[model samples]
Target chain A: MSTSHLHPFDAALALASSAAGLYTGHTSPAYWNMVGPFGGITAATLLQAVMQHPDRLGEPLSLTVNYAGALAEGPFTLQATPVRTNRSTQHWTLSILQPDAEGAPVVTTTATAVTAARRETWGVGDMPMPSVPAPAQCKRITPAFRSEWLQRYEMRPVSGALPEQWDGSGDTSLSQLWLRDAPERPLDFCALAAMADIFFPRVWLRRARQVPAGTVSITVYFHAGSDLLATTGSGYLLGQARAQEFRNGFFDQTAQLWNEAGTMLATSHQVVYFKE
Target chain B: MSTSHLHPFDAALALASSAAGLYTGHTSPAYWNMVGPFGGITAATLLQAVMQHPDRLGEPLSLTVNYAGALAEGPFTLQATPVRTNRSTQHWTLSILQPDAEGAPVVTTTATAVTAARRETWGVGDMPMPSVPAPAQCKRITPAFRSEWLQRYEMRPVSGALPEQWDGSGDTSLSQLWLRDAPERPLDFCALAAMADIFFPRVWLRRARQVPAGTVSITVYFHAGSDLLATTGSGYLLGQARAQEFRNGFFDQTAQLWNEAGTMLATSHQVVYFKE
Candidate 1:
């Protein structure tokens, strides 16, 4: 009997059929070029596949991955797999694969993820999900600046792009226009994780304004799993942004996540490395 | 020149002295009896002395301690040493230590840290810090019924404590609270990081009354440095509490940190396992 239901495992990499959802994957200008960097959407989609769906096979999800190596602005495929699916928890590995000049593939990452247990004595009650205007009533932000790849996915920078914004000092914070699974497609949690990564540190720092780079780690926490298409907004709500360790080209900063209604969502922290 | 400059690296233990001011230590009933746990605060203080005070002739702090296979709590000590200091950046390591049962010494942790580099560029600027009063001035909300540990920390729950009525379906959600550096002690990014681990999650899950013990990973992002003592009633704000994943006897959540001015200071994500 072919089971239509995904196994308790194999859920981390919930496959996506299109990019019309909240965190959709888009191809880049230099798609065939293996040396170019991966677009934000690609990163988001990979994350969604790895973190959100790993447990479909009936297991828990647990894993971590670091960029062992990268060719700035490259093309790659993100593949997620279930490493171990147990009754208590499931573990998974998500890999970013770059196709060689010959169309052969090279692996870039493998993170281990696990699911934690729940406590019998529970406390922090849930914050009600903000009463969001139905997506149909929400406005959409336009992608001010576009890349060959960014064009495939929709993103609205909360602030209009700045010209000569590169030295890292003016408008040091960043807020993005609300864009999720596009109108036609829905994104998974792994994909959402990837998309949220774009929401951290201060994206404005990258508008050709700051020192090359002072970053190393980027971390994200998930609150409610969102269906990419169902979550929509034209404008964006900016949370908190902070810079702590910025010595040299390696720095760590944090930003808080909030909904359009101003309800706090999640907090994001990461280390960024500027290519000086 | 026999001169010393405090580094921006965060220390897990509250600072005893700083050019800013001295922060006296106090033992709260929360972890009162666990002060002597392996590699607890005792060791961290010695490490702090060597790292923070230049006049003290101490070898670089590095020691290994055994877990002895049991869970333990603090008074956790954070000791730091500058691995390298420069105008652009400084690298340091902080160790969390504890004393053994026989009063013997043991080392718990050695974490790498780096200070942020000064820059000329400004992309996005500062988020509005709250105009709220200092933490000490904030209204202290003590539930008619409260936990000893919660009291030791002096939490001013902005939304008030968990309600007395409960029907049993766990509804872990978001909570806002004012946290003062208790025992009249001040804390830096590192010390605050550890303290953050102590509460927020429990508060967000207020529906669950039991203490949580099952923890997998605790990731903290320090935005800038903060001395908790100088923080008045509004000094420290728990912006948002998020429950990312919760299953079995474990859960993972993230909390945003802000100064009284409402400046985003840091973000922390933790994986906890409540075995009891």
Candidate 2:
């Protein structure tokens, strides 16, 4: 396989070879998180493995990723296995392993992807889109945060802005933003899956300061087909995320992503491990 | 391994023996769905495996289960593998395998569980509890539906009632109800996980009709700690569920579970495969 013609996302997920589902890829400094590669890109890379597999059946309907350990800055190996294939759906389990000092494989990440053959059916959109300025009217958030991953996405916050400093007086943990790939790539399932996780932690919105918080697990349900995303093209997506409850050093956030046409593209939920 | 003194919830998850993190359990007819055991019970059972494992750390933060195949009415083997164990968190991958006619093991279900050592933290509840009548004031829904799973739980629908028949004319896909175990068992993580999935499909609520619908994947994030659940006891839990969108043979639903005191217990989301 040649690498010159691939998009940035595809290039980031490029595998060394298809044999044994082995992938050796370096973390792009462009999408680097504070500790490791951005979780969204890591998630996208995992899904991309299945999408490129020879036995893949359909597009991803749902994906769940659990961040177990931190990844180093060098090459990492990913192994994706098609665990089960039904008549109309396929299930895959993937793991990202990084060797430790002892030369033993340590699982850094794990994920489950469900793909299915979709057909036209009764359709309805019950969630109303939040009224926000169009991407053209909104100002792009400057990269004032010290995160490379934040720099990879153009975010226009319509409601909740990142706290200026550690002020614990904010009342609401809701954020509505217009987001897209920084370089303006067209929408696809892989990119959409990654975009689903671009929201800042809800706790940060409630309290202005950074806590020791990280997402333990995240689940995404894709509601739009590839055709819908293709039609959406390289356009900004309207996203709204909020936490329902925060307790016992943990909180859960729910978010929905929609295109400019108000078509719901995906709904995502995750639980974050936070410290007081 | 004495089942005689166990709660029904515990009895349903009773395993013969756990060796090398493997568990063997049978499907309880009390919680049977249309075909196999209720998806909720199956999910709870899988989580129970990890809860009982010796290597398990902390409490369950999030769980995701994917139904790959149907479970036969017999014994099933569950393998819980601790893929990663961090300082304060652990990740597990589980599979429910049942032998086919030819005696080859076939994976029927797969799940991921994240557990962490939780500590008290600055907390807030952003989602307001739905205003509904107290459980004592509401009438319990008698078992009119054919599902044995429905008979196993007492439901008091405050808003959307199951339509007498499928007519495809209802307007909205919202259901608000008070739900509890039939025998009035004390609430716990396993029971709460099961309760998260007890809501009927939102399509049925809107259409006032039934179509072939099955959940492909479901995720639940536990918000209440053991102390809170113990204090809440066997009281009915207020629940509200609704779908954001239904399109292309699939739909996504989000639900929240809360105690009578307006404390959120868990938040759940799922994607269902529906045929028109």
Candidate 3:
């Protein structure tokens, strides 16, 4: 397909290899958040660099990304290094850099990823997918916020949602919703990584106050492979997220994503920084 | 206290600074596992390097460690680098290296940590500590295995015990227990990090088979700071762990640690590799 005809998700994740283990990418206005590009898109783009590397070993098993600082809107450079490669697994360290006003490259993000050649074995899903209304039955939510990233996905809330009053009367941080790409892109590892961060900050829901918050670090464990993602193509995923504790200007939320077939696709946990 | 009089946990975590951001440490026989030292102690020791670093910005906010390979019994070198330091937050990258048979240093583990100068803010805990008997009321477990690490911690299981029969008829992977250092060491961040990994591989509990399994990557999010840990003192921590999904020779477990007073201390998640 022509570059212009490609889906927004694909175009946003496009990367060019300038040198070995080095990539240059641009920020997509389509996925812009309040401050910068969506954190999910940035995470997926970083994973894309490793996935595109010739030296990469099998598929992604786990990924951890830490946002050191918000990226300014512009082009950025990414470096992915394979620190250790074992017989069945490979470990990588990655970073994204953008030139500051002084025209010097500055690190804005850091990440570590583990990829492995997984083999079939005994498997089970202990966290069963909760029964909820089908996506077609639930009303799609259109957030009133101006974040461009929120408009790129179709969200249908099943439980916890954004507070209507913002009066600090929230009782819980748990949020459940059916979500998928707005333009309906097929499922893939990069897309799955992005989808894992679809949930908004849990603190906003827990406190019913619009506190300033952003993810400091996020870790995602992939339970599905390429074949599984293909089988779940273009389908709505049920996502559930909840904060365990919010203390000392920080909180953590754990989330699980399951496909229409009830297969658990991924589980993610993140620590967020919040200002009162 | 003299070196000889130090607690085993302290002795195991002792580090000698060889240079800036470089530390030399030895494995303690008290915490040895099947092939090497327990993963918990190794994780705790890695965190110690940053904690003791002169350039550290603040307390740990999050830590993710990837186990590339097992450490050989003996001495190892650790290098911690402050990749990005902001006004209130600092990001670090760390690795542990051990000499191979060829007398060349090789990387065996890699980690990333975030430390921040936290401030008081709105706080809440959604995951309440489950009701269970006090530590004195529960009987301690004595496993048939001969791993030295098991003897270092006093574990009182409240549920999800190891299978008595290996007939492949296992069920849930949830385990709740009261844990504390057997020698009665006070609680700290390092101790809490180690306790996060105290639960055995959840697969063994989910399935009735003793399979070969090890943690591939683990991430711990700290909710309590020095003050909270000090308040916890030498008291037992009630830990709960459960597997969300087990598939394709890999599974992830989520855990929470709470002090006797029902104060949530930390939450941890890990992805484990298993062989059929």
Candidate 4:
């Protein structure tokens, strides 16, 4: 595949050969978070490594990424190893590490991919999509802050907006928005994986102030196949996220991503570390 | 400490040192599922390995277990490695492997533990406890089925009950129940982890017929510390679980565990593979 015309997400995910099961890449400043690269991109890049591997079987069923340490804004290496492969499922462990640094990897992502020769079975989606205005009707909130990654996505708030100050009025930590890649990239496993983490920290939504908050671990379960993504194409997705509990300098958030047809594409969960 | 009078849960989790950072265990028939050991017990056992580690620090903040293959009912070796240890957090990778197996490891579990010297912080749990009758008022659904694991916990259904047959009547995949360890074991991290997975598959609750189903991956985030667990101690906990989506032979379930005081303890998410 030619790389010159690839989307920024695809281009940033491009890797250079280092060795068997290992590749090297640079951090994209465009997707930079306050500290390291945006977690979604980092997660997407890790999934890309597995997808590009010749031995990988089936499609991504679930992925878990643990941010073990801070990533130095420079070059880094990714090591992806197939931990196990069953008749219908495969397991992989991937790590993004900074060379010459002692200790554990900066980020570790584990995934389960199932290549089930699926038999037509029963299915159900009990969770109802939220009643919200159409994407065009919602107002796009431009970045009033200086987050490079925030600018890369077109986000229209359908309900919750980032609180300006801690008024301590509303206690519900819920956010519903319409989101799509700014330059408009078609939906795929990689893109969907990244979109899962695009929601702002639930703590921020609940409390008016931003504390030292970052996702320590996040997991995504993909429910849609490539055909669904192809049919959906590059379009806005309804993203809804809410926090279940917040306690002892930590909290947990659960989120769902859906197509306009109310088809649930992915559901994600993450435990975040926050300082009061 | 002598384990002669230890709870069955603790006894089943008992491990014998085989080598450095590795232990051996046998499948306890008391906790066996339809196929291998109950996945909840398996998950608890993996967490037990970390807690028993000499150099382990802090308590589990999050755990992700990927069932890579069917665990053979025999002696299995567990290799738990502390991948990284920071000032306030630690990361671990664990594998359950049956020796002499040619292919993949049986189960792979990864965890992040935070040893944070937590300062008093603002906390809020917006997720309300489901309106259910008290434990004493609800009927305990004795398992007429054959799974040994079902007998280990006393479950009182408050909302969704296991369908008598696969009759497609209800479309809501929600289950609310009061549960506690049978014979009354004190609430601890291992026991709590096991309780998080005790809910019946959400698909079965929504569909009329049972299809082949198994959890591919499950992640649990602990919101309570040892102090909270100790205060709650050996009491019934309210659990509510619901599915957000089911498609392409996979479905996702989210669950919460809370004490009688309406304190949210842990939240979990899992994706299951299903067949028609």
Candidate 5:
């Protein structure tokens, strides 16, 4: 029950409820991005607020997070409102607010999530896991960059590694890799949500140019439930990401995560803002 | 302007302003689905509210709509709130409220959209348009079902046509088609948004079983601007869609739209609830 004993992932997601649908949380240095905390962890924290809500229904089926603005260091207020609850599904709208330069609370992030009581049904995985060398055979990426968030994830790039040369001549944008939490945390909806955003901007690799890029919006669809995630445990997940188009200072990329057992756990898509 | 002179698409999206961030709209029979107005049209209507807003900034970058409940055949109240407005992008939270059986307004649909002033930058189309016959060469599909919405689009399926049998024996879920407005309306974001959801439930095609299915959440990323869309005019767009996974009564699919010149227009993804 103590925050000190929790994993960094859980610690970063820790929230204290002061009123109905209102939660207070803090940023973690371990998952800090260039300007703020990683968007994925922020997404997970918002989902955690909803998960802890007393009026929560079922589990997370889909989540969309919008990074409206940068989150400052220290505490922020998150409001998770269940906008609608149906017989089998519930919809939630969440927003995170932090003080602006003018000493007024302003929205830093916005999100919408759907929770549903899943039922047994005919199941199928249309995308087969990409064939790649096992995690042991892959070389772990040692970040030369200053992103604190990179150090939080144990990533083994199988292809499309950050450009060996930033000459702006790259042709392909595809990247397949094995990834997991650095400290080895068990898989869950929140953690999976965080992992869904692990891929760096696909434009960087596709153009082989070191341009500024950040995720503007990210959406994740969970295909597996708690049981399957529990079974997946702390194992490395195979992730493949690629961009469909990069135009007008924006690009969208989609990625899929699968367990070592080759079962697809989640699929995620994001639109990124880039400066060329 | 009178509604009678507007195109059917514009007529279906017609909204009457009541107050700041609030409007009222009715479901058009021209875009009616099996139980309600087509989900794509509903999405476009919500986006339309923002486009018509006095405080709206820039063009649409991304939109995510959650179908919280079935929309009845009547007028519904729509609220579009710009929760945050950055220098380049604006975030909006929108919801549709309609009277339930007890005559009290309830949330029927909820959505979030981002509008941004796009800038010139390095651009590329990573996902190539699949080579297919021109719209003139492909045979236009005649509706075999009673859904009024089917008649609104002129579809020329190149692959993954609806099953010829109702037996549960199917293989792949990929569908490629050339689609355009039935009455030859000009290309625009609203019509493109509606066309994004034109693909029928992939589960039916993948399983060859006509099970009940409906979209729960849909997200679209706009890749082309109004200028480019205007260049596209009323020509058919090449669309390709496929399901990634189906499990626990839900499945997620991804789709891409491109012009005849091989330029990617938009990419859309959705999570659908299906009963098997």
Candidate 6:
């Protein structure tokens, strides 16, 4: 929305309505409002709507949603189609539609999913668990200071989020935390996807530099031993993510999850955008 | 291919076939020859196949292929399908089929493609550039030195690839070089993806520590500029990429790309599977 062509109000109203349609797809707004505006989280919710829960050893894959357009302020509509559901992986396509004006079309984006059964290949790729005792024993940092948007999830930092150390006194630049599916819904990889995307600014200590806001998109590869103990509408969540990339305005992070025992679990990636 | 499985001939045949099928989705001894037991290069090739090329700007999109399974002796078949082609973004789905002789299926993986008409975003993200004037100003570290890879891309070392002092004159923790696309190609985002993946090993002076040999999968992402100008790529693929997380045989690197103006051209993220 710009003055070069369209009025701001016209664009905002149009975006709001389009956001409703874009967020919910062809469905009503009430359904999608429950689906947040965060593209990564929204993508997770879309995956949840189509793919059935993986039963005992059942690997019906649910298609994924890729955020083609950066997440902006407004409503969004999502469209999903089931391609095939087999024992190996459930496949589908999810589309996100961004609205403009009454007659103007919004940005539409989609992704295909392929969930498969667990197999062994010795991906052999595992980062050792932190030397820290536990998330409970770690310090606690208030999220309100940075993310007003993270209120949707119950976040309890394990290492309490490290402070900005000028001389690099930190032993580890990583952080860990436990969370609950807010609104108490069954947790899935979607939740993990959402959780990883928001874990950035938290990991990058706010050392008095201006927060350069930008967009982020993530790709998650769920491997064996990665699953949630949290029930769909109830349970606890554990998020172990480390900020590894913050070069220029582009940042990247990889996160892993596990119930306990330090067992390796689902791996997720987060790409954060920065505006200067 | 397995021993407890079906025909040995079929398994052996698929092994070679899958390797060749990786690049063109057609099996041949030529492609297989290009692929080897090296997982790092193999993974990079597979990612390139799935990545959307710039020449295909107006064509349909596809995921190309992702690492389904690598036996180090993989007969991996990479398959891709056009998801959809639209005015803005094109999507694709790619599958890598890993065959098994005794097992039902060795490995199956799929990835989504988001191909969009890219726009130019101008920025000088405060990143520094190497002092190298251009590729012509840089000298290739001879192949006689047995650095074939380094020769392909012009590496103008800010500090000689060797230690200045007997006790190690410079920071062993870091090294900077000017590297560019050799001989020039369509220099687009996919190539940008390729550039990022390869720049990691150069981050540190090869301190008698085998780098690439230990690296596994280098997952690279580009958040911005796509075009690799004949001059730009000719000047400096300047800047540096550093490892952020390394544990349990897997390490990750985040790369920052800078132009001669000290402007940030793009950013890259990659996960490397390697051992210390």
> Top DockQ: which candidate number?
5
Model 4 bad stretches (over 4 Å): A1-4, A100-119, B1-4, B101-117
TM-score of each: 0.51, 0.97, 0.98, 0.95, 0.98, 0.51
Give the Å shift of residue A237 in candidate 1: 16
True contacts kept of 3: 0.88
Question: What is the C-alpha DockQ of each candidate?
Answer: 0.09, 0.88, 0.88, 0.63, 0.90, 0.08
What level of docking quality does candidate 4 show? medium
Instruction: Write candidate 4's Cα lDDT for A153-271 as tens digits.
Output: 99998887888676766567899999999899899999999999998888887887777898888898888877888988998999999999888888888999999888888899988
Residues B241-265 of candidate 2: C-alpha lDDT, one tens digit per residue = 9999999989989999999998999
TM-score of chain B of 2: 0.96
lDDT of 4 by residue, B7-95 (tens): 78988898988676799988888898888888899889988898888878888888888877667777788887777777767777777
**Which of the two, 1 or 4, has more DockQ?**
4
Residue-by-residue lDDT tens digits, candidate 2, A1-276 = 576776666777777754867777777776788988888888898888888888889889999999998788888889888889998789888899989999898999999989999898888899989887888888888976798788778899888878777778677888898999878899988899899888888898787767878888888899988899999998989999999999988998999999999989999998987888
Candidate 1 root-mean-square deviation in Å: 11.2
On residues A1-276, what C-alpha lDDT tens digit does candidate 1 reach at each position?
A: 232364211222334532221122323343212334332333444555644452444222222333334533443456555433444444443556566578766544323344433224432323333344443354554534443334333444444333354564444444434444333244344443444455433444534343334233344444433421136332343334444433223445555545555544444556565534
Ranking by TM-score: 5, 3, 2, 4, 1, 6
Query: How well is each residue in A1-276 modelled by candidate 3, as lDDT tens digits?
Result: 256988899999889897879999999999999998899999999999999999999999999999999988889999999989998899999999999889988899999999999898889999999999898888898876999989889999999978889998999999999999998999999999999998889999999999999999999999999999999999999999999999999999999999988999999999999998
Q: After TM-score superposition, what is the CA distance of residue B198 in candidate 2 from its true location, in Å?
A: 0.3
Question: Of the pair 5 and 6, which is ahead by DockQ?
Answer: 5
Interface RMSD of each: 8.5, 0.8, 0.7, 2.5, 0.7, 8.1
Global lDDT of each candidate = 0.42, 0.88, 0.93, 0.82, 0.93, 0.43
Off by over 4 Å in 2: A1-7, A18-20, B1-7
Candidate 2's TM-score reads 0.97
**Native contacts present in candidate 4, fraction:** 0.71
The CA lDDT at A175 in model 5 is 95
